[model samples]
Target: EPEVTQTPSHQVTQMGQEVILRCVPISNHLYFYWYRQILGQKVEFLVSFYNNEISEKSEIFDDQFSVERPDGSNFTLKIRSTKLEDSAMYFCASRTAYANTGELFFGEGSRLTVL
Candidate 1:
């Protein structure tokens, strides 16, 4: 079974620093997304990418964030000027193109901490 995988399972960075979280979605998945869960809070959608472009994005995914598919296999999220509020578990997810209602496959998540 294919699944998403993320790197830097946990990251600690100083406020105002930059960070990049990486994810590798299942090869067959056509839709990819980045979501975050602030401790003790509900999960929030960050951005969604399809066909090499951003299909949709949430308010929280402001100018400080960016996503890329650099190649055929890797998807990445870059956060510039990290803030204290940016601390959270960031998840990378994907779903098949045909399964409009398909459940999203999520990675274990990369925990980001800002000091």
Candidate 2:
């Protein structure tokens, strides 16, 4: 099956640096979302985008993080500044539709390590 893929399975960056995590989501999908899981915390939704604009965003998606669909198949998340709390696994997910319920397929994850 087609799946979302993220580059650089693991990234180590110094604090205050910029990091751009890339993801190629499945084709023919309508909804895309960004979620993060801290070392010992549950997966938390950061933001959901549709129609080329943000549909919903959680408090965690602050000024530091921004997302964009650079092209047809590519979606990227840019962190302008990194912090120790930002060290976590970032997951890209896509769904065929935003109906009552649908399974969101996620990439293995892009692990971010901030020093």
Candidate 3:
């Protein structure tokens, strides 16, 4: 079985700092996505990427945020400036293909804490 892996399992930063969350998705997956869950809030979609281009994005992915697949095996999300509201658990996910019953596999999550 394969799964997504995220780095810096936990991050603590100042309110105005920058943060880069990294992930390595399943080798054969075609679609990759970044999602976040603020404490006590629902999971929210940030963006989706495929074929090296952004396929879809939510309003949450603002100018302060960016994603890149820098290489074939890794995907990364960068936040230029952190805010107290940016504190949350960021998740990386992937799916091999779209199917009526398909499911997305998620990484353990990178917990971001802004002081």
Question: Against the true structure, whose lDDT is highest?
Answer: 1
Which segments of model 2 are wrong by more than 4 Å?
Answer: none
> Model 3 over residues 12-110: C-alpha lDDT tens digits?
999989999999999999899999999999999999999999999999999999999999999999999999999999999999876235889999999
Better of 2 and 3 by lDDT: 3
> Candidate 1's error at 46, in angstroms?
0.5
lDDT by residue for model 1 (1-115), tens? 8889999899999999999999999999999999999999999999999999999999999999999999999999999999999999999999999767888899999999999
In the range 4-112, model 2's lDDT, one tens digit per residue, is 9998799999999999999998898889989999999999999998989999999999999999998899889999999999999999999887544877899999999
lDDT of each: 0.97, 0.93, 0.95
* Collision count for each candidate, in order: 0, 0, 0
How high is each candidate's TM-score?
0.97, 0.96, 0.95
Global CA lDDT of candidate 1, please?
A: 0.97
Top candidate when judged by TM-score against the true structure: 1
